[model samples]
Target: MSEITPDLVRHLGVLARIQLSDAEVERLTGQLDVIVDNIAKVSRVATPEVPATSHPIAMSNVFRPDVVGDMLTSEQVLQNAPDAADGRFRVTAILGEEQ
Candidate 1:
């Protein structure tokens, strides 16, 4: 397995805009080496024959019938509105420009 060098750590630190001390660089290098080795092992086992799947169980569309039900009157719809104007609920202006 290849070891992570101090140069590599320094380069990574620079790219990430992080300033690491000598001790931190040494510690990170060892950790990074182990991580890289583990990733390499995982990559070796990932083959083309293993088909990629998102879920373990089969799924199908579950839908309900689209049917229009009871409708509310205009008075019932605007009953809870704090402010109503011209037979509609009055809301604060959303756009900067006035309509």
Candidate 2:
């Protein structure tokens, strides 16, 4: 198991460019020690027989297949538009072009 000493915590604070007081350093040392010990316990339980995975159980894509179906005709599509021209929906020019 790795030891989380006050000195190690102070060094990490310097590397991270954060200012930590003596009290904070002492407090963090105990917390980091617990985290390291917990990770060590997990490593001991892991076995070669178990396949490594990001999740606890098997996962797969649950999405439906992408397939093209019947499409809307130009007249049917333009029926709901406020304006239509040349078998297409017409809108005001955004770039100041006179129509």
Cα deviation of 16, candidate 2, in Å:
1.2
Candidate 2 per-residue lDDT over residues 46-76, each given as its tens digit: 8898677898888999999999999999988
Q: Report the C-alpha lDDT of model 1 over 1-99, residue by residue, as the tens digit.
A: 566899999999999999999999999999999999999987888789877667898888899889999999999989999999888999998988755
lDDT of 2 at 24: 98
| Candidate 2, superposed: residue stretches over 4 Å from native | 69-99
Model 2 lDDT at residue 34: 97
Please give each candidate's TM-score. Answer: 0.66, 0.62
User: Which one wins on TM-score?
Assistant: 1
Q: lDDT value for candidate 2? A: 0.91
Model 2 TM-score, 2 decimals: 0.62
Steric collisions counted per model: 0, 0
